[model samples]
Target: VQDPKHAKKTARNQLHSGARLLVLGNNVMLYRHLLTLAQAKNHAIYIRDVVNVDKQDDGAAYRLFHSDVLEQMYQNELENNEMQSLFVYLFVLGDLFDSYLNRNIFHKERIIMAMRGYFFLNMWAEYIES
Candidate 1:
């Protein structure tokens, strides 16, 4: 507790502040807005399922949740942000480039690097996977 250098090294080594998916206790967070949205769409999107890997296997493997679930979560988070700038990186903006609406606009050539956004995505995966 008294060692600053060791504390700094530990901080650097840590995976950092985290989000929880409490499968062991079956306590998961369902956002209220997402619940409303799912109800409106007439679909309940459950994130996890128990599936047996093989007939010989004694137990089930918990497959990762569908990409759509993560995408929905990402989209919801991005939408909730005050700036909404994350969409340009998260969602494929390729369609916007082909639209006639964008025909007259000047687009920058590689104005931003995608690695930063990807780093966040990888970091989130670490939170989920680890």
Candidate 2:
């Protein structure tokens, strides 16, 4: 298993240097650890699936290796980061939000913002009650 601290250090150093990282492996633990660290640091990472031609040709079905926990964590981190970007685009770019709305792409953002707002309100309520 890759050390979590080492993975974090590598990811941070790479991002700081504006370099792309390509980790070629099927180690679920390593991927999860790196992704968790990336989420904590508000860093953006993209995952591209690489299909195995050998497996396909061998008549062996291609199956996803990641567990549900890993997939959920990845999706949550991605949506959270996208939500942050949505605000930045709306405030900083000025015209980008209008363009998204014109293309009907704002509906997804509307749902994400509503869900996030609800989550924060629940957290605040719990804090106040406690």
Candidate 3:
């Protein structure tokens, strides 16, 4: 179903039939798919762009920890023990810490971020070390 035309047709059909769409693809594909859906019904689509969040490292860790993404990553690590997905969680934490440190953030916030980084480091040490 990688065909652009087929993908657009499916997306349009799903939108017309009142079904929720979950599309997973690269940026170009996603952009085209979104365009197709928007064209299908003007001013009817509500798009929440969660795919582009790398620029916001400060709240990235907080949002990930509070959201289902962390749980999903944990489940993936439990099943696969690949350590790759787990690394992403830890990496985000590190990125958040770096972002906080580089900026003149509040001391209390920095302390909290440091604690979070430490906690995850200890929790995922074994997997990370492997």
Candidate 3 accuracy as lDDT: 0.39
Candidate 3 or 2, higher TM-score: 3
lDDT of each: 0.31, 0.33, 0.39
C-alpha lDDT (0 to 100) for residue 114 of candidate 3: 67
lDDT score at residue 63, model 2, on the 0-100 scale:
15
Q: Tens digit of lDDT per residue, candidate 2, span 15-118? A: 22324332222111233443453344433332221121232221111112113323444556435443332222122222222222335547776566546645
User: Order of candidates by TM-score, top first?
Assistant: 3, 1, 2
Shift of residue 83 alpha carbon in model 1, Å: 16
Q: How close is candidate 1 to the true structure, as a TM-score?
A: 0.22
Give per-residue CA lDDT, model 1, range 1-130, as digits (tens). 3442332223212211134322211223233433333443332242212121132221111111223433554655445642133233213222221221234444442323234434554665576677
Off by over 4 Å in 3: 1-91, 127-130
**Positional deviation of residue 122's Cα in model 1 after best superposition, in angstroms:** 0.9
Candidate 2: pairs in clash: none
- Tell me how far the alpha carbon of residue 108 in candidate 1 is from the true structure, in angstroms, after superposition: 5.7
Tell me the alpha-carbon RMSD of every candidate.
15.2, 16.7, 15.5
User: Tens-digit lDDT track for model 3 on 1-130?
Assistant: 5542333234333323324322212111223333332233332233332233233243433333332434443443335434343335435454444434446767777777667766765765654455
Candidate closest to the true structure, highest TM-score:
3
